[model samples]
Target: MKRRKYPKANKMMLVSLGIMTALSLPIQAEEEIFQLDETVVTATRTEQKVKETPASVEVITRKDIETMGAERVVTALKLALNLNLSEASMVGNQVSLRGMNTNQTLILIDGRRMAGEDAGSTANVYELDRVNINNVERIEIVRGPVSSLYGSEALGGVINIIMRKPEKPQSTIGLSTGSKQQNASYHLDLGKQGKWAWTFDTLFTDIQKQRRSETTNMYGPRQFYNISGTYDLAEGKNIDVFYERMSEHLKTTDYTDDGGREYFTNTRNSYGLTYRGRTTRGNYELRTYYNELEKNTDQLEGPGSYSDFDRANYKTWAIDGKNTMRLQDDHVLTFGGEYRTSEYRGTRLEDNGDAVSTVTEHGISKSISEKSVDYQAVYVQDEWKLSDKLLLIPSLRYDDSNRFEDSLSPKLGMTYHFADNFRLKTNFGKGFKAPSISELYMKMTRRPIPTRTVIVIGNPDLKPEKSTSYDISLEGEKGAAFGKLTYFDNDVTDLIGTETTRAGSVSTSKYVNIDKARIKGVELEAGRHLSNNFTVKTAYTFLDAKNAKTGEFLQDRAKNRYSVQLHYDDAQRTGISSILWYEWVRDYRYKDDEDKDTDYNYGTLNFTINKKWNERYSTYFGVDNILDKKIDELVLEGRLWRVGMNYTF
Candidate 1:
């Protein structure tokens, strides 16, 4: 007799099928189930239940974050449908949603923009790793373009991190450690006392670096702290202020130097003040904020060449206000305006020991070599309840900038209750992403090989990237069962790419709007409850991404992806609990450092068990990548273990 070993993908499929079958068995649910009463504010700037939103939205609660052992926002979103995540190397750890590129995604904290690499790219991406989950109350994810509300980088989607604000007095402390990682966190909430309240939170994390022959880049320790306070002026009127800061150490081992390493620290600091009040028929908010990002090097122990620039800094300041009014029982209107300024500063050493940076705003002939830009935007939206079962929303926005042509974004959204416990939702919109300072006015010189020299230049005349987006879905919720099916399509133009012109051994590359593309996908998610203690959910996505002009498939776009989760807990919400999660990805292609095509598929399984000793103490333990899966040593980490304990008072 011979024994057969089943592949990991097959094992995942089997587990999924078994769970589906088990959910089909005849059994009565013991208590209330499904997400029916949850309210979200991102979709329309109005408080509405998840089932009433005009777009597809997913919410991750605080319980989900602790149960899954997710350290950061990126880890919690890894298994979500329609999101493409790269889990391999330090430089490639990014997530793209709806087949759109990484640069088009927007991340917000309490409705304010976060830091972007400080100076990482010419793109609009925030380092999701810097956001610790300790203070997060919930995360709201809205799929598809939301330019009508957020403007610019809202082309792909929006992710909003909502911090915890206590409804009652509370204090919590947590400690956790892993095979190569460790964390400590504290949170304190002072419930409203006579008209004043405040909150404080802090987190620290340290992890061992991942190195293969002392070449690949790595991640290091990080720290975060946040504080906020509110003062009440009267009934329905208040003033709020907040401050936050974070720092992360980034490292890369030097292969040329025997005992050398290169590293830099990314630091972010932000603060804001806001005023809110409600009248008899409307509510309004006015806010002002400032954010700064910088990169610092460690010149004492290693070389001072972690980035192209010796030092880099980016800063942003904004004043924003909005008001929503209820005119009639069936009519609602919302409008707002904002003014913002963004500046970038950098200096680099030349081959001759002199600093280089020329401030020119004209063309690629000279590096933008220059400074900053300012923007002003205004937007309006109208919502109409035409009938008992139909809702229509129309919105428009105009953006004016000092550097480029003005842009107008318009969107239309519809929701119809076609059947009991089910609704049909659709959204059509136009979105855009402004060219970054590094993209519009950049100039760089590089020597790739002994015989070749390359110079890269930026174009100041470049237009912003644009996209036409559409999505339709049917969502339903019933007794212990919930499901959704969605179809998304995005056609993009004025895509920014590089073009090379070679003369002899010297090559000149310039940025231009030289390409067009199309990204379309189908997403399906379904879940059911077996009883009060057990619940199961599964999601699948199929993506087709391509370049319109070349008709070639996009790099790193997986054709199929799947995830399944099984959860067990106490009916009273206090006792032992467990979560078993599995995810599989298939048919994806990527170009490695050497520019060689690497095609592969992989799966991972994770488990966590938690116990509550009493009202004040709890503990959890978990294992990730239980099968010890590995791919080319550049992807997922092998098996890892973690344990943690928490106390509340």
Candidate 2:
């Protein structure tokens, strides 16, 4: 084994932190309250312990995110039960869950959908640089069908990003430097007793230049800010407002076969505003968002000039209102309604000349845009206590959209407690998804003008896709030991995507209400405290995806994934704490027409050490990719290694 030395770049982080400390004078001090055992509000829409949630849910605490050396949102999710990550483009990253498409999984920021991206793909949790991690309280992940609670995109599940609110007056500053790039961040929290509370966080990072396939110097810079606050009006009544702005400069280099190289650059800006109010009668929320994605390409060394440039923009506004009432000793009822309007615009212009000498401008010949969706949905759910140890939950929802016909979904679930420390829950549900504008109506050109064909055609009569899902879970806890096991299966129909055509090149295959697809999987999680000084946590997942009609396995589904973590903390040793983690994942083989079986297995090990000098100050060091293993998370793409540190005050 080799003892890896700290890179000189690490000193840059220390120097930056020293300057931040010297600039701020020691002012007022506040009590630092440590919150372990987080209470989740997303799994059931009510406060419950992670161990008590009947569904398969993973709750990542802010402490866990910080200690794991994870800066982005999706990095924390990598070790989750069954999630797959892929890069769609410079600005687009896709995440699929339980062998479902990316669009089937819903992403929620404080219980609201992020401004929707172009239909087929979306930025996952990590791509949302808008929300600062310093402003996050905790993340709640509900795995399996949640369309009963959240409409539409929740067919796979829901990931809710809960932002941090000021519990007390506090402020913290942090700086970190890592391979290829580095970032600096700050957070300010203010709380006034019985009146108001708010938080503000900002971050800036410079990305390092890297050569992908091509030998071009390219890197992406990210900057973002978050502002959120709450106002108390009366008992059980409050108002919450949140806003976020994110900007990033993304660059990608591609090697060409004709002794030339190509470089792509994209500028993305996203902004969102949401307001919510709750009263004794009910709750209401209103949100509006705008996202602009523009791209500019420059070939550093090529015969052709900067050509085939484009931009895509999405704008959305939505309103959601709900009410909950306790009708009887055994019955609780909830009802909600939501409306959303979204618009997508695509524009492009091509250059036909040299670098300095501008010759032909193709004008904006490819300005095809559509404002196709204004969706509405109404939902209701009821929880009935059949007995002291038995409960039943039933829900129904209806969605109406202009491009697609109406849909009705129903869900039934039950949770039974046979013992004080053990419980069993089973849920059966139906879900649906409407075609995106891109899928229904888009014209793209690939070859040189005059001869390119419209590869994709819209079917004005496209129908909404649907799925039926079932999940069974068991949870138990005794003293310091906790464990959970879940099994899930989903059958999908009328999934829309492109398939190989007779022409050899891919063409848009019309939506076919065809064969049934099935995804069956199991998840196990366990955690225990070995002693007062040591704790261990681990999880494993096994998945099988197949076509119910053909009896053949689905493509690109990982067979096995597992993770283990150990933590040790000692107050006697200068308040020192340490954590060691290892993760393993089996590669997913594509089941193409040839029936090939190619596989790859990879693992990662990481460690972190932290010391609290006193109550008000703390510093931490972390090393990731401990083995320096060059594992390609996405084969054909470059490998990744991340490490950093932080000091909080």
Candidate 3:
């Protein structure tokens, strides 16, 4: 028989907390909430218990994010067992589910799509950095096709970020600093102050990027802000308005032999207005929103000489309305329609050595190109309670767009309770994704020299990508333990990919349909409460992916990934909490330019501690990669430290 002893760090933390508890003000502690019986609103666009949903749904609350000491969406998403995190060429990080690319996974904020320069890449707008962590109430992840209600961009799954709704008056200010980053934020939540409730939040971050031991890509002074308010009109009726904005600038640290450097700037703005009404039989909502994004990048060949640059703008407008009704309390019927319009315009410099510093310096309209599309969609879904232990949901949607033919998507979901604490669920759905502006009508050319030129063009004849997806799961819960196992398969046809044609000193790359692809995977997740103060959780994912036409494996598609976490809380004592987490990844091998296979397996540990001094103050400390794990730019950058403090009044 043997017993493991606690680490010295744990004992030191407990002693420090005890001393603080005696010296600090008196306050009551609140237990952290984590269970499988919670309610979610994104699975079916309606409030339903997670355990009873027709599909697998995962949720990460605000408390979980704080406990992990995560400041970005990409970091927090690591906790989702069904998701795979990988590096993107442009954006630092992106996520995929069931081995599908991020473009197939729709990301929504408050149930609305965001506007950004897609540029035909899986990573869209950099929401990983723009989203204010302090303003997020919870994140809902539904794994499987949901195009029957969400239309395009749901071929793999859906991720919805829900904003906080204030019911009490409180304001908070926070500050944090790390070896490579610094952050500051303010949040104001005003409760029902004479029928007018509102919230305001802002965050500023500066991150110093690195390439091994060298300094570079340091995006600094990133600013973000959000403001919203609600006004009561009558019983069960209200009007809400919201506005958000983000801005940032980045420059490179390495310079070319010719004294050339890279620079870029980005800005985004979004606003919306919504009206909601509820009655004895049903609820209805009508809303409209506008989003705009601007981005520009350039390479400075020398002082005041801007070369190889482009300026782009994208805008989105949407109007939507939906109604949900209850019929005899057995069936919940929901119907919705939407009108959306998107436009993109961009211009690239024609001459690199012409000493042009700005896009408008030469009336760039001659080099500018534009594309736009309008979309109309309507959908209907019915959730039927067949009995106390059986549930059935059927939905259908029709979408029309100027760039693609009309398409119809249908879906079916069912859940059956076979035991007192166990449920079996299955889902089948068809999904659709229309080509983006860049993929459909892009025209750009680059001339590194007078004799050589490279061109990237679009294909107006490209067809829309479609997928047929299915998933089934078995879940159970008893007392303080719960577990879930799920299997998912997706078959996508007419996938859009690039093909290169070279002739002499000229090369052309065009977007085209690249046959079919198949991806399937298994996910296992389980958690248990060891005692009143301790909990443990583990998750694993296994994937099998292939290109149906060539039978080749998908690039960067990992075969095995897993994570483990152990948490402790002194909620009944000094209001302190701590967690130790570790994750490992392997089998995502790929061939390099030299035709050599590259495979590396690595794991790291993260530790964080949080202490609540009282109702109005709190502090936290954390360290990432305690073992000093490093993998160049693909993984961790050795060990990093962070400390934060917040005050509420």
State which candidate has the highest lDDT.
3
Alpha-carbon RMSD of each model: 4.9, 10.2, 7.9
State the lDDT of candidate 3 residue by residue for 1-649, as single tens digits.
1122324533433443343233223224423345447888887877899878897788998877776666667666767876866654335556576788778788899998888756556344365566777788889998888999999888888989888877689999989888656789999999888889999999998876655323344455788899999999999999999999988887664443246556778899999999999999989999999988897777565666655677778899999999999987789999999999988777632232123233453223326656788999999999999999999999999999998888899999999998997999999999988888788777678765458888878877888899999989988766666677789999999998889899999989888988699988888777666667887777777788888988877866667667677889876434888888886666665555455656556667888888888878888888878999776535457788888888999
How accurate locally is residue 536 in candidate 1, as Cα lDDT from 0 to 100? Answer: 87
Quality of model 3 by C-alpha lDDT: 0.78
Q: Sort by lDDT, best first: what order?
A: 3, 1, 2
- TM-scores for all candidates: the values are 0.90, 0.82, 0.89
- TM-score of predicted model 3? 0.89
lDDT of each: 0.77, 0.64, 0.78
519-581: candidate 2 lDDT, tens digit per residue: 888877776656677877776677888778787766556666676778887745347777887
Candidate 2, number of clashes: 0
lDDT of 1: 0.77
lDDT of 2 at 466: 85
lDDT of model 2 at position 436: 71
